[model samples]
Target: MRIGIFGTGGMADALGAHWARAGHELLVSGRSAENAAALANRLGAATGTWPEVAAAADVLLLALPAGAVLDVLAASGPLTGKVLVDCTNDPALTGAPVASRIASASPGAHVVKAFNLAPTDIWQLTPPAWEGRPLSVPLCGDDPAALAAVGTLVRDIGATPVAGGGLDRAALLEATAAFVIGLWFAGEDAQAILAPVG
Candidate 1:
């Protein structure tokens, strides 16, 4: 897969590094050309402008800040039929779900909400695991093909993909992220809140 990383932050570095190791071609671009080039060099990938990367890649990862998503997506060229993986989380974002918002802004792009539940350090783990179990990633998207593509990427990083229903449920995932992240910061075991059902 040809993956386009639309940021230079920690999420971009961690995820991009894994995908690069998995033999995917990567194009990295960010607000800072120098930063993008640096990240690209680190991942052994290429650097390009947002529009150029958007045009050239099969799948695009929006590892950018939630506040910058719409503006950056708008600036990127038309994303018709592209698989767009949204990993942004913002507790303050009201109104629509971030992935839904991205879908609306891109028109024809297939948007999948994923990689938002955990911290960047977790993703840095080679196939994140706990208690000898592979970490399960939840994904929300409307298109089957798009979901499958993102699921493959999730597996590429050595995690299991859990079907999280459609795009309408994305806000639920976002809310869960906010809740669990808050718990983590509070030094609580967020996982303990949910027990295995009989």
Candidate 2:
């Protein structure tokens, strides 16, 4: 898919890199030309300003923070019928506020919430722990095609995709993040924690 990402952080870069590796036409956009170009160069894809990014992509990814998404979406103008992949979390998440916050502003696109539970390091260090025993990643979205496209990409990374149901199920995904964090703080092994959630 033609993926355009709106953020310039580590998370965005990691996912962008994967998409680039998968041979997708990836666009990295934001206010920072240098940052965007740097990431784009690393990914060996294209880089541009926000407007250019929005105009030339099939799938748009909001790698921004939860609270930032609504305002960005509003300013970004109508994205109706577009496919949006959100990796945002609620700031009020004392124990994972709610993953539904990923769809703030009630996005018009096929919004999917995946890749939020784990650290961006996972993508850089390893897409999944092992090639065969890939990590189980939970996802929730409304469109079957969008979900399946994402499912294929998730599997391409050697990870298991757990269809957590419709878009509203984002709340449950958030709860899982909280649970994962709790387990980690309580000293549970990382690989063993998210395995059963599938």
- The numbered model that scores best in lDDT is 1
* lDDT tens readout by residue for model 1, 1-198: 999999999999999999999999999999999999999999999999999999999999999989898999989979999999999998765878788889889988999999998889888888777766778999999999999999999999999999999988999999998899889989999989999889
TM-scores vs. true structure, each candidate: 0.96, 0.83
lDDT of each: 0.93, 0.73
RMSD of 1: 1.1
Model 2, which residues run further than 4 Å from truth? 94-107, 130-132, 185-198
Q: Least accurate stretch of 10 residues (summed lDDT) in model 2?
A: 95-104
Which residue pairs collide in model 2, if any? 93-97
Predicted structure 1: lDDT: 0.93
Candidate 2 TM-score over all chains jointly: 0.83
Residue 89, candidate 2: alpha-carbon lDDT = 64
Please report, as a residue range, the 10-residue window in candidate 1 with the lowest summed lDDT.
126-135
